[model samples]
Target: MNTKSLTLRWNKRHWVLLTSLLLVLCLVMPQWASAHAYVVKASPEENELLVTAPQRLTLEFNESLQTAFYNIKITDPDGNQADDGNVQIDPQRPHILETGLRSGLGDGTYTVSWKAVSADGHPISGAYVFHIGEPSGSPAGLKDLASGSGAAGGPLKWIVSFTDWIQYLGLSVMLGILAFLLLRIAPASLQREPMDVPGSYKLLWISYGAASFAALVSLPLNTLYESGVDLNQFSWALIGSALKLTSFGQIWMLQMLIALLIAVTLLSGYDLDRTIRVRIWSSYGTLLLVLGWLLTHAMTGHPAAAEQRVLAVTMNFVHLVAAAFWIGALTAMAVCLPLLTNRLPAKVRGEIYWVTLRRFMAWGMGAVAVLVATGIYGSLVILPAPVLTSLFTTAYGLVLIGKIALLVVMLVFAGYHTKRAKAATGERLSRSLKAELAAGAIILALAAILTHLSPGQPASAGPYQGTETTEDGSVITLQVSPNVTGENQFEVSIKRADGSVVKDLEQVTLSLTHLDMDMGIYEITIPKNETGIYKADDYISMPGNWSIKVHALTRSLDALDAEFSIKAAKP
Candidate 1:
């Protein structure tokens, strides 16, 4: 009954199983597993004044959306819901969602509030205001900063993040312990009688239980998140909607199933000297299941939403596998310090401890090599141009910095532990392991927090610029000086392919509008400077997406106009 003895065995059949699972993960990703969907186009566009109320409210997104738990509500100036309860996606055009508006909607300003689950299962919600009659003094939005389409907020965000940390900690520990037992410790002791490390095994079960709880709770939590329902408002409908409508819900559901399979496989194993490794194998099924489990983490992670899917997901999987082995093995070693027990003589135990530490570290160092390399590459990919600016200016960057710092400290502790292993006492080794694990726990916390954040932190301290070419080879360059959300100047330059400036423009007006919510447009007329530059001063009310429409006229009766969007970062 101990170590859940099922007495079966396995072998190199695992290699084939592992390869097949890799192919499945690499070749097949969820069709709609992409970025969070936001409003790309809106009927009666943001801040548009209508002489008469529209018959229906429609919104379009860059990504396809699901119908379950999706809503489109129009709130009148008095803040009353104005749209009919039925919101549905257009059958022909999967990206568009529409709902009928009640007749005779009163004037003033009406806000369209929307909520939807992206195919990947992430919840996104936002609101925009459009006036029914005359232009209201200003667009009615930007009041709730968190309302911008993105991750969960309030207690839910923290709850989900904390759960993510537990899930990671549990899985990594279990994986590391299994690798240590079957691959390292068991082989080394093959000449001796089959031995058991109860301390390590017990730790394994504890991790298993923790991971299971996280997997079980993940569904309900994701339901609440994607459905935008509070705990008190919990319902079966929320869970159903999440499972059927969002990729996130389904992805986690699959992971939970795999976890249950692992539990069953782990409980049964043969433990003779010849069959020790085979005990955990189960005809290669266990290895396949473990890898499939890790693959799910990558599938639902930020990498799944990346533009470079294969590279990002592959890099992420390798990083996850390496980290699981490294951190997990270290955790297992911390629990099973052979020198600390009286089962063996002090001199003999010391030598065993040294050997175990050295062997584990040799593999751990290789894991660390991949971890550090991928970690750096991922950081660069997530935080694009002006990387340093994004790192210091946003919450995501701040957390990443802390995680890296903790990792550095953990590495220092590991290096010192290795250096002193030959002459170390039991108590010293225990202290060193505890320190490293402590830092590791903090690192996981940061990593968990990061999952709930968007890595596209628009760089704040630069002249944001974009260039577009016209059919006739004319180029238009738009620039924003100090792209942070505050007072700033914008510049527009028109040039031909031959590098000559188009100085004959009669008039140029910039229509700046906030895309996340309704804001009064910044219609600025850029009078040319005596020095021959077109620029004007303006202010961005908040951090989000914005649109800049260029309206210009040529002195010779020709017209040149272009529209583009830019992201403004938080100040």
Candidate 2:
């Protein structure tokens, strides 16, 4: 082929390969890491047919829930709520959810709807049904009556995620300023006569102001985020509840304290006297506040909530401190270094610039080493064993991999800049450093999103199911497999009321209908086996609340029904 044709063909092949890889990821990742906390088991169980009403309902999950934000409502056949409407986490078991049920359940089916904010801060919810005494002959269709799990709505989630990004950016910038001031600017002034670096001071002030604003805004934003409170009705009560009740609120309080300390530290640094600068530098308060800020950030993240909390938090703290030092130096090089190069005498500029960069290089190397070490350790803590496999299979792992890739790019830039430090000065070096900052910020954003994702196994492919027995003489069990829209498998099993495998059934038919949305009945013939198992494979066009009914004809008529809340897979 000619050169142009060959190039075109290669491009087409690359596109195909990329497309295929993405398709594979779409199919495979959900099997490894789903972002939301998922139900592991529930009290009375989904579609459980109870002979008597229970005193309470409980749910167990694979991830922790925000106890203050979860809700459960149970509705009886008569449409009265059976639950007291108060949801609580078990004190002894953080993942086990419990709620009191109203007494006096009659002989009919009852439905439950629940919504809970996972510890990662995303809301998830669903509905299930269970009958007391007997299976209601007709569909109770209590879909509307079922109170939804109060998952944060879409707009609210977006707002929270955005605020988290902005807050992290502000904090990183502020920390960078602190590192630059303490390790670079102050030290440089001590080595020689103090120089006028207006740009560096201006950048410091900007970082301080931005960090303070972000910290203040974060307090209320986090309150709204955690409580899932709406803007129209936000009040002092909501703010008070967040501060007293949620972990995020407590962390926000600590952040506010850090912001105040940062202000003090900046003010203390204003005196350029070597003795005062050294004294302020030596002050334990400043060091403690900085470390405490890092510690609190760690405590408020996934690490604090992790199984190996001590290790996770320690690694997180080390990782953050090292990263801040590196990013701070780079930011200083970009925004503050120019001030020294541009304003200083020609002869002193060469000497001071070289000295400052050499010192920065030594410290930067140590920081990068620590950053890499702690990053690896932190990843191990967050991800399950067989980390290599999870890196490809899980969403958190994928994002982490993306971050590592970006970090590699940053390291390359840092290496290049370090080599050229003697030859390159002013805007050229600053441009390279700015590129590194951009990459670093993106990594932080990815980290924020990663915090909101569950680092666990994917949802099960098995069906959402229920079992019931006809009053006369037949037992029926129905299951909706893959529990998601598009090509679901329905499995039904028939047995005699006395608990024997059913045989010699003339015919078996299954019909499905949406509970809320008006989808007319869709029916299918389920082929039966001699062992009393009947199965049909079909595709559900959409996701929503669906009710499936099974009718069997033998010497007599038998019927069983169940409701399923099917979810759509993420695109």
Candidate 3:
């Protein structure tokens, strides 16, 4: 065979080896990912509880849970559910679920059941029972706490957010480097005398091949972890299950495509076949890297709303391709720039670098435009006002803000470097570009941190207001109270439409519901000493919105029923 044919054969062999290695690596990483700490015990102890009623139920897990998804449920002997609205994670101790019990239960067995997904995406579920005597006659026809369900509160959300940031930053940097090489450095490397070292290109192909595998495997595993699936069960079967049910399918497919492209490129290079086949595969590999960005970032973005999901997917595809072209070019430049500066005539290398830089800048600008447009739309859709506030107020929010700040800093640095590189003479220009690369690394680190912070609920207020009324009469009244207080207290007075005091009502029963958790009935027994004014020493445990159901009963007959809501601002 001619030397040319021998080169082609060698490239083919190289491609096969890299592809196989990547495939194996993708299969093995999930085990390590799944081995993290999980929920091991609960105070109510998963379907087991004492006959004696306790004021609070405790949950103990093998690992400290992320505070995002903590909650619990209480079921009466009759199966009526009293949901305690919001279950908060105590700040002083991060693992504890802290909240207060509802009123009304009088002497009977009750069951407390719970299901939570941890910060790392593991689902923890169990039940326990306690007794509440004099059980307010099971509050006719109340909604069962079991009827309501939601994702668990904990750190998994922040983990997903942080991982996303890392994936994007890493992808951007890698692509930028590749783009630099293709547009600026590759031609320079080719023009020079070919190095005699055997399998030199193998190092690049292997590293990228490994990255492609990690990207593919990690994307799906991350998705599964977020969805509350058991990571320990990872296998071909599980992978197939996730592909069928999750948004991860698209990510997996993209990874596979990139892996294939990598294999083909390696093969072409090893075969010493610098024919159109090699160029085609290399270009395809680059294209796959670019497209991978959409599968990873764009679909989850803000602009993804009005446009159909398919359209979002398409736009993300374009966005990723553009980013890869930009970043990949940067990678290529970093590798070839030093060599070009050292070996070639200074004037000739400088001209080449300038032309390449201009090309990369155009592509980078396009990627930025896509990122901005899509990002804005995504924020509007996914981030609503209250969640955004959470992003800033909560731990997750602070990190995200920091990440954005760093990204802005990176862009500014890039602009400065671009200007300096254009005007500088000799080594000064090279130094400036190198400094810009270092700055990019810092930005990537910030991106990683941002991913760890919670996307949090956007900031909003006034979703609730306070009001009061007599259950039987046609009197409506608004009460003004202090904005902040440690003790939960509210003043109330009622009058008829004619401004006469509502003296006919004998008693008012207050049933408070926290979020969905029912805090039974608190009967406001009016003492003869207090006249028409009724008061109780009972106080709520925390500050927030509490739905009050007021029932007016006269003698044995049902007089009337009325509903009023109030917001308890933090004191």
Candidate 4:
């Protein structure tokens, strides 16, 4: 082929490669980005030891946290209030909050209850038991805390972390590549003859389009994990519920816009009517993409949102758009720099790449600045002073630190890429830029892992401790002892039809069924102590007839359950 034909051919090849990458990225990013929010660590670590009573408790989340209608409750061993006051967002940490524990908790078992809206606006709540002093009576058995006994398993946690990492890395790669294509190749392609704008447009749209599909798949996976459903028998309702959440809804809407943009861009390639409308739609679609990013994460408390939702939402939009532009521009530079060198005259291509690199560097730097400023402001709005130390000590705090570290690495790569692009010696420059891009991808993957880990449980009394046992292979035995007042404790021993002690059984679970209240049934595991015996310690807060159901699983996995009556009288 002649020199002119050869140049055109190379351009076509570049376009094809760019389009393929976009398509792959879109298909993969959402799965990585849409990880479920979790608590990785908390203040007053599980089974913690405090030399003295703490003035306040803090809970940290892995990602930015939402503060609307957050609730936390602390009750002493005897069911007396331990919470000093209402729960409030702390002023120092972006993803955590602190609340006062009611004073004078007189050394006893305490139950901390918590409920909060995650960054995505999902409400999550649970309870943990902690003691101010030495625990009384025998502790509950480990079998009771195992899987099938209602306790989360280690494997499940690993799955959550793995999926989270996948989504994070995927999103970074997808965004980075798209940015590279738009800022670098698109402009050049437009300037060339017989502009393949339609093809380039398809690449861009498909990248986002694939992202939506990936998100859809991820939602179902998340639902299954959360519900602990068998993969083969996963319920569609769970998937439907996941889609209804704000994050999924925003992404779905963005996908629609992407679809429309692709249609308009393709039609614009032809001598189409309503050209103005097409342009308007295209611009609106871009704006929606920005909005999608903003709204998707807005449920997480924004620095301004703690004070007012309107301003927070607005700032969040700006932040997301800026990020997209920065990442997209960097990706474009990486892909185009080499191709441009091969296509245009050496000096002309070099100058073009340098000028583009300089502008993007400035823009990316500005984006980073805004991200940091807003991030700090947001943290202060939610986290209080007392629990600040939890940020580093807890799981959630560590993840946040990891994310910050990754951002720093990205900045370093950006700096190096800019410097080398400006001072490249032909072939060596292209390879170096590619390596930098690869490094950015790795950073994103780490972010994905961070998202999957739970931030930390709400600062509470700590973990429940007590013992349970079943006797004579037919009788169930339980003993209750608490450190706090106003909390009800129940101890019940039930005799089954068979004379054998229930202790010979393989597993034991206890449930409290209440009447006239929606307290919901609670299931607890009973552990075996010295000689063939099963024992448990559980709380029942009010004086009432509580049907205690003892379910014993034999070694054969056969379950035998017995019910007994119990009453709690005010002390």
Highest lDDT model number: 1
| lDDT digits (tens) for residues 414-506 of candidate 4 | 767656544633443455556655655555454444334433322222222333334435445555444121243444344454654434456
* lDDT (C-alpha) at residue 250 in model 1: 74
Ranking by lDDT: 1, 2, 4, 3
Q: Against the hidden true structure, what lDDT does model 1 obtain?
A: 0.69
Off by over 4 Å in 1: 1-35, 91-94, 103-106, 136-146, 185-187, 190-195, 270-280, 283-287, 339-342, 421-428, 457-542, 545-571
TM-score of 4: 0.49
lDDT score for residue 294 of model 2:
63
Residue 445 error, candidate 4, Å:
3.6
lDDT of each residue in 195-282, candidate 2, tens digit only: 2344655666675576567667766666666655578877888778777767777777888878687667656655565466554563
| Clash count, predicted structure 1 | 4
Give the lowest summed-lDDT range of ten residues in model 2.
26-35
Per-residue error at 122 for model 4, in Å? 5.2
Model 2 scores a TM of 0.70
lDDT of 3: 0.46
RMSD, one per candidate, in order: 9.0, 12.0, 14.5, 17.1
lDDT of each: 0.69, 0.63, 0.46, 0.48
Candidates 2 and 3 compared by lDDT, better number: 2
Instruction: Output the lDDT of residue 528, model 4.
Output: 45
Q: Give the lowest summed-lDDT range of ten residues in model 4.
A: 142-151
For each predicted model, how many residue pairs clash, with residues at least 3 apart or on different chains? 4, 2, 89, 75
